[model samples]
Target: MLTKRLFSSSSASPNLFKIGSILKQTRTFTDADVLGYSELTHDANPLHFDAECAKDAGFNDRLVPGMLVASLFPRIIAAHFPGAIYVSQTLHFKLPVYIGEEIIAEVQATSIRRMKNKYIAKLSTKCIKCNGPLVIDGEATAMLPSLVIEPPNLASASS
Candidate 1:
């Protein structure tokens, strides 16, 4: 389990999330996306870059990298849970995600625990092809920053 501090601040309250709280995002991976990801990450897998190779491997089209698909989870988490630390994640790649296929990434909070000044949440994560099949299944743990609100100064108000 790898832990990463995703952000630092007190912009969001840990109370924003609760058991069964859910978030969903939809995306369609394109040729440009595949090329750019390959260029940046040097993943250059034949299944991702070569259609013939992918076909030979039993897929209809060039496959998207599993990491690329899994990356959506972090994006969803960070956007909805600002200032939350992405403590750890576990992923299982279940099926090939082809280029140009629309997929939906979803995260649901399953549990929340308070530890002193922060809240730790356990989340269920998954991605599914649009009207098709499940592509990824996973879990994530995050540390949400606690918001601090100071009481108004009574002496100043009295003056």
Candidate 2:
């Protein structure tokens, strides 16, 4: 017989490498939030803001596009992960995120590898809410200026 329990599958971990991640938490994904980002990033993708366009495209409503969720890296890096530069990111969408739906996005370090002067952080990401489990799972690699070489939080200094 098989028993069912939460977190029985993949083990979720935290990101740790250059030392500045102080910490963070889950957050909601909002239409207004995404729309504002679209304007700032100058990426006026209809899927993020145009509800009608999204509906026509087969979404229940204005779905938060993939790229938008991927953008969470920036917010994560800025908010709590204070010393990393996103070098590569890959996310597999399991479902669509409708406008106004709250999403829990997380990036936990799975492992770390050394590369030149910087380091690579292998992370596991997920976006989950009332709809059930995560709608997406992602892996990301970031190149960071190590405090081991410079100072603490130096990654955010350039911004």
Candidate 3:
């Protein structure tokens, strides 16, 4: 099952997200995605490009690069948080993801910390194959933009 959610920057605020808040997005990696990623990153591993080599490596088809699959977490976070900056991430590849398989990327706010002018969010991130198994498990830290409220304009009020 594929699901998409749109979040607008105008509606995004660090204060709006709380502990246990969750976001999920789904995607099916295709040949074009792999090709583009490979071209952009120069990741020309045979397992990702050669089906026979993939079969020899015990996978059914060309394997999608683990980093490419893990990238969904940042994409989801950036979309939802707008000005959020990624601080760190940890990943564990438990299973192989093949091309054309639908995968769900999920991020949950595990903790939220306020640092004066910034909000730091610790998130639990994971990717699962549709009706299959967990392919990647990870954690990430992001710094969300602080909410800035403009002081009421005294000149306008006086005017």
Candidate 2 stretches greater than 4 Å from native? 1-24, 42-45, 49-52, 114-118, 144-159
lDDT of each: 0.75, 0.59, 0.78
Superposed Cα deviation of residue 121, candidate 2 (Å): 1.6
Clashes of each: 0, 2, 0
Q: Best candidate, TM-score-wise?
A: 3
lDDT of 2 by residue, 1-159 (tens): 332212212222333333223222355667677777778788877876777898898887777667776666656654544567877778789888776777666666555556666556666666676657778777776655542222234222211
Candidate 3 local lDDT, 1-159, one digit each (tens):
232222324345533566656677788999999999999999899999999999998989999999999999888777666677999999999999999999988888777777656777788999999996999998999987742312222211000
State, as a TM-score between 0 and 1, how close model 2 is to the true structure. Answer: 0.63
Rank the models by lDDT, top first: 3, 1, 2
**Model 3 steric clash total:** 0
Off by over 4 Å in 3: 1-15, 146-159
TM-score per candidate, in order? 0.80, 0.63, 0.81
- Candidates 1 and 2, the one with greater lDDT: 1
Candidate 1 residue-wise lDDT, 86-129, digit = tens = 99999999999888889998888777777766778788999999
Query: Top model by lDDT, which number?
Result: 3
